[model samples]
Target: MDKQRDFVLRTIEERGVKFVRLWFTDVVGTLKSVAIAPAEVEGAFSEGIGFDGSAIEGLTRTYESDLLAHPDPTTFQILPWRGEIDPTARMFCDLTTPDGQPAVADPRNVLKRTLAKAADAGFTFYTHPEIEFYLLKSDKPGPHGLEPVDRAGYFDNVPGGTAHDFRRRSVRMLEDLGISVEYSHHEGGPGQNEIDLRYADGLTMADNIMTFRTVVKEVAIEEGVHATFMPKPLHGEPGSGMHTHMSLFEGDTNAFYEEGAQYQLSKTGRRFIAGLLRHANEIALVTNQFVNSYKRLWGGDEAPSYITWGHNNRSALVRVPLYKPGKSQSARIEHRGIDSAANPYLAYALMLAAGLKGIEEEYELPAEAEDNVWALSESERRALGYRRLPSSLFDAIRYMEESELVAETLGEQVFSYVLSNKRREYEQYRSQVTPFELKHSLDII
Candidate 1:
């Protein structure tokens, strides 16, 4: 730790970094930052910076608001978007109390606690997310309504076009910040795009997800366009989903792999899939936490709505990607239901906890649903023992309220706060009259 701190300080001086930003997230996944002068970086690493935590959502109560932001030196990176003049650097932080204990309400701490359990079981969780989002002409809907920067479809390469150039610039900036983006291309929806981040450990991946969002937005602004991760931003178009590929590792070996087993998936891998399938509904609120998120789920444009697992079945919640011969390390599963808008820390924690529980309990892996789940009738799906995910934020909250796994993983403070916050969001959404209602019901009713 001392060596890392020294390295960070030396780099700040050597790179002429004028400011170091301490970054953390609220329970709901909103990024919060505080800038400190380069001279204070050393002090921050040693003693941490203090702040009033009550101001941050789901952080603390008003009376017990004092908290500390301890920057993790390993996460240090210079802000490439800031350019050469008055350069800025940033690090992700973990919140702790005055006595130096991890804050129970901190989202990062929730993930850390979960990862520790996996480590105890001789495993490390790794994830790679295919994040999909849209670039709009403007932040707000214009006179002609919300307009995409381009009308290109999936994998469409409009050379020298807005989206192509935008992705080129974005990927370069991301690489400069040390984020390994494996692939980037236009997605199914017009003006929609997807970036596939290379796999990393759970904690690093969550931090990278947060940084990825910020970079996407910053690049969008620099190019005079707006980027949105809203799961279902447009009607009659495919929604943005963060289909996350996950695997477990035991030291250098991929714990999820087996040489000759079906799909080359090990027993540990099957149990992990069982855990995810069994608890996916309960964790849906955290993974897809907005009213808009349900729209993407039920809308059914490759966004999973049913809790089932199968090899190469995109409609199933847990999908085992087809294995490559002699490449056992690449064997993994993809959880298809999580939206890009989720709080990665909390979401990833719950996922790890649920998967670990399955392994601990030796949960039985069910029959694989190879057929298209979306095409099945409700009765047919029910006959096959397939269950639907929460249809709305209201339904998701109800499942979350009943989830022992979620409650234990998030701790009491965050569990209570998330429930309360989501309930309020549901209420606020229900009170509003939508354009659909007015368009259809005003004259008819």
Candidate 2:
């Protein structure tokens, strides 16, 4: 704690940072901030800044609206996208009640609480996300179509590619803000991109995800383009997903590793994967929260519709990358359904909780699906006892509403708020008319 405070102060002095933004996320994972002068950093750190929480979505009731945002000094970093004049820095924050108790509805706090449970179990959860998004011409909402900045496919290095330049600048900006990028390349769609982050502890990864989106948008604005994390931004194309690799560890040893085991997957790791497959349908709403999310999930382009696992199979919702000989630490599971638009805090919390529950219950692992599960007919899948995930936003919400594991993982406040908010969104969306409806019905009728 002392080291972080000193580093925070030293960074401000060295970087000529005049304003420091204390950032936090609401329940739905929108980044919110309050700027403070350099001289006020100490006081702000000691006594958190107060804000009316009721104004923020899914924060607090009007009567108990006053909430405090306490900055986590460890997250301090300079805003590289900002200009030299009055340069700014930012740090993620934790929201709390005036009495110093953690605010139940705060997404970050919810993750922290779930992490505490893992800590009690003597394990640390690590995550690395392969986040895919798009580089569009600008934010202009077109008439039922998206304008791509460049026509590029997976790993296509178009020289002088405007989208590539934008990605390079975005990567540099993220590094300047203390985020380590693993790789950045064009995705399997026109004007699509993927930027993967190095693995880190779940809480830090959540913080990094919030920062990553902001940096991407900031760099896009600076480069006179627009970047979007919307799942299925275009029709008849591969949709973007945040394929996350996760593992659990005990000190220096990988808890999920076992020697001489089939596929070198330990019993613990298999159970964890079982837990994920068992609960994935119930928690799908949290990971893919938007209406467009189902568009990606059900698009039949690599998205897994059924609950299944396999070795290095992209069609399964959970996959175990082939274990490297003598490399136990590298053993991990990848969840492919989560989109980049998810609330990382809630998503990671539920994931860890489900895995831990598996460990605790010693859940039996299922057989692997070698063939492409997507190619199999419904009867074949049914014969294999495979179950499909929720098909739409409303269906996901219906499953989420009854999930005891999800509720316990997110705590009551967040679970309730998320369900209510998503239901309302689905309601509003159902009431709205769309171009597709007009085109299909108006002329025909």
Computed on alpha carbons, the lDDT of every model, listed in order, comes to 0.94, 0.90
Clashing pairs in 1: none
What does candidate 2's lDDT look like per residue over 365-398, in tens digits?
8889988998899899999988888889999998
Query: lDDT by residue for model 1 over 9-112, one digit each (tens)?
Result: 99998999999999999999999999999989888888899999999999999988999999999999999999999999999999999999999999999999
lDDT of candidate model 2 versus the reference: 0.90
Q: How many residue pairs clash in each candidate?
A: 0, 0
